[model samples]
Target: MELQKTSNGHHDLSPDRIPENGSPVTRFDALENITEGDTFLPNKSNGKIETQFTDFVGKTSFGMSIFNLSNAILGSGILGLAYAMANTGIILFVLLLTSMAILSAYSIHLLLKSAGVVGIRAYEQLGNRAFGRPGKILAASIITLNNIGAMSSYLFIVKIELPHIIQGLLPDNSDYWFVDGRYLIIIISVLVILPLALMKRLGYLGYTSGFSLSCMVFFLISVIYKKFVTECPEEHSYNKTVPTESIYNSTDGMCEAKLITINPQTAFTIPIIAFAFVCHPEVLPIYTELKNPSKKRMQKVANISILTMFVMYLVTAIFGYLTFYGNVKSELLEMYSKKDTLMLCVRLAVLIAVTLTVPVVLFPIRRAVLQLLFPDKPFHWVRHISIAVCLLFLVNLLVIFVPNIRDIFGFIGATSAPSLIFILPGIFYICIVPEEQEPLKSRPKIQAIAFVTLGFIFMIMSITFIIIEWVTGKKTSGGH
Candidate 1:
């Protein structure tokens, strides 16, 4: 087996051809002339030269593609976004959601354009080609951190909801119901995630998307119905009209005020909402799996996915916010606390949906990290290790810290959200290629400006929050 470099710098592999080193190679056509019996010559690595482009062969349809993209965006974030929006006003929430949708769309488009130029399918690979080792490391770190935060958020949701579901199934005074919430979280994660992680292919999980989508819809419907049907008494109302000065009178008062006040903290939350909806970078593998891998087809898939996600998000945010009104809590479980069996069932459905959805969303991140860290090793150990580590972290989180959903959202938004949603996409776009191609070139300048500006704003807000929290020593429910 011999490997020869073509004049164009691409490697050509052949079996029979005895290629000399440092030869003046003209074209791939010259190498085609060599044959071994009836077969083409193989390369030194005992592999035959294949075509430059691999054929796209995947079972995902446009609908599944949209479902996959939407599920990625709608994960754990939707659980908390309404409360974040309620902190701001309804009008402000709508405005922020719109801005986030646009930003997410632009960021995803830029990532796809970069993928086209580099002829790479993975984000880390593209980052390596575009920026260098440090850039690759940065990309991997950002993705890993973002995913850890996401998984933590999911774990928090599960911790709150799973115990209730278990208790509901048990007798009212059953002695067997002595399981700790944190222990239950670990058990639920193992029972739910390990098998899913061990699967050889991802396509099987596609069906679960239908279940997840249904759960999300049901959760929304339940909230809407509960709000309309079960009315809160005027005395029971946590809603109050207070002067701005009264808001800052005491530490506990400030915490309550922060929930209702529309200030810079509220303004800064736009990027968190944006982070929740930005699923574009993850679309590369989906695009590569398309039956027809053309620019137009890829664009169509992206456009449809983004549009579907936008509508779903808009509806979820509006309904969730309006349902809770001024007193909305971060987690949907807390919002459903006052409801009866029907609403409890809705919460249960959401918990199941999110639990199933977690492995699918987190699998890619685990795969990427394992590949980066242990490129040459078999994947079985990696898969097991990743799941164990994730579960252990969740257990520790639940044990040592009890986070209210709002604090969890704030931590996620401030730390991991900005890097994943803003910094990575902009850097990937700017650093990937020397110049932009075609219709993409027409928009790069504007896109670059918008991404940079948004990134700056997000980082500023995140940093400010961190500083304020540190100085004031005042922590919310989810703060570590």
Candidate 2:
């Protein structure tokens, strides 16, 4: 038997064991063994070696991996950012956004570092290795919650904007059932989202993702274009049911962009920013798929993706906020005149992009549910179909009942965003990386511990603020 090097610098005990080469098996070596159709068992098998080996044997290129990760980072969060800027003024928003982007990149570093040590790529698997089944469950739960929030946010956009698009298309102002976003969401979900979600594999949607991201680019360009064209004192009305103290309550002076602004609603700024950068769950998967998946290479992929999104997000928020200033609603596009031909096209693009994206986002949540409930079972269509149906049902309910898109963004950002981007990755790194390689007292581990602490603090503070808002019956006017 080929003996593996143990942490103690000795060969592991085994029958007919060969002498160790004094080097622990690398992830590439393990991958190579699996490539040769051999079982790539680690020095200490977590009973998930096969799953890890099979799932990560990818052939995707570096450029493709970058594209995949960048797409993951790009989502409906873009819609709320201008509102985030509205709440936290331009200077503060830029600082907060910049800080979150840096922290997100750092968090990915910790995750990649931990994964390299264990030769495991899956996020939940790292959790399992670190803290067993409970860890696995917690990781899966966080991913499910995060993705469900995302799906809900996307659908919420559909519910809010789809009806308006329909209304704008008709010849007259006569009320139609299809013009009601609530009913429209249901119909679209049944006809469009369900079929797409039901697909056994979403490999065909790569081009769809490209298209969806292109829509966001179109959105950003439109936002920029509107900033120049839209007059400073433009008299715009809220398209949806906005909060009491919104557009009508705005003062003439409120038109000027502020260097700093703070209010009760400012508590949500971090959470919203957190929500936008919660692409950590997607990081490892992209790493696994990368052509020459090294921590450094994957780190480069993540850094580039986050940097690109950062520029896009910063510009979008700045220009979007500049366009409406205090008059900007939670959904930036909602700030625009729906009758404007360009704005109409922008709305349709957003609706189509988000509608198609729901199915893609739903995949992870459904997969997590299956992993939690049916860990040992092989693929069965009944279970698959049932889970997808059930997940969509639950998400549809959330999209319908949730007051606005901001709540979805804030709540998930306050909770799962921090966990995925900070808490879990920090904890996983501190726990999974061996003491021999780096002790608990080491700088890296110390930083990771601090990272976990920061996440907890952010979560507790944001949740407290949100609860206070609920108790006082003061909703932040981010969306209808």
Question: Could you tell me how far off, in angstroms, the CA of residue 393 lies in candidate 2 after the best superposition?
Answer: 2.8
lDDT of 2: 0.71
Q: What's the lDDT for all of these models?
A: 0.57, 0.71
Q: Residues 1-480, candidate 1: write the lDDT tens digits.
A: 344432112332321223444344432233323221112322234465432222224567666666666666667667666666655655666677678777777676667665655544456655665565566676666666556556666667777666676666553633454445676677766677667655554455666776787888888776666666644333443334422222322432322323334543454445456566755435665665555455456667777766766676667666666665546555545656533677668777877777776665565565457436643344366555665467445544643386554454465557556666667667766655444232335467557756867787787877676567656764322211
The TM-scores, one per candidate, come to 0.76, 0.81
Off by over 4 Å in 1: 1-56, 169-179, 239-265, 376-413, 436-443, 470-480
Q: What are the C-alpha RMSDs, in order, of all predicted structures?
A: 8.1, 7.6
- What TM-score would candidate 1 get against the native? 0.76
TM-score of 2: 0.81
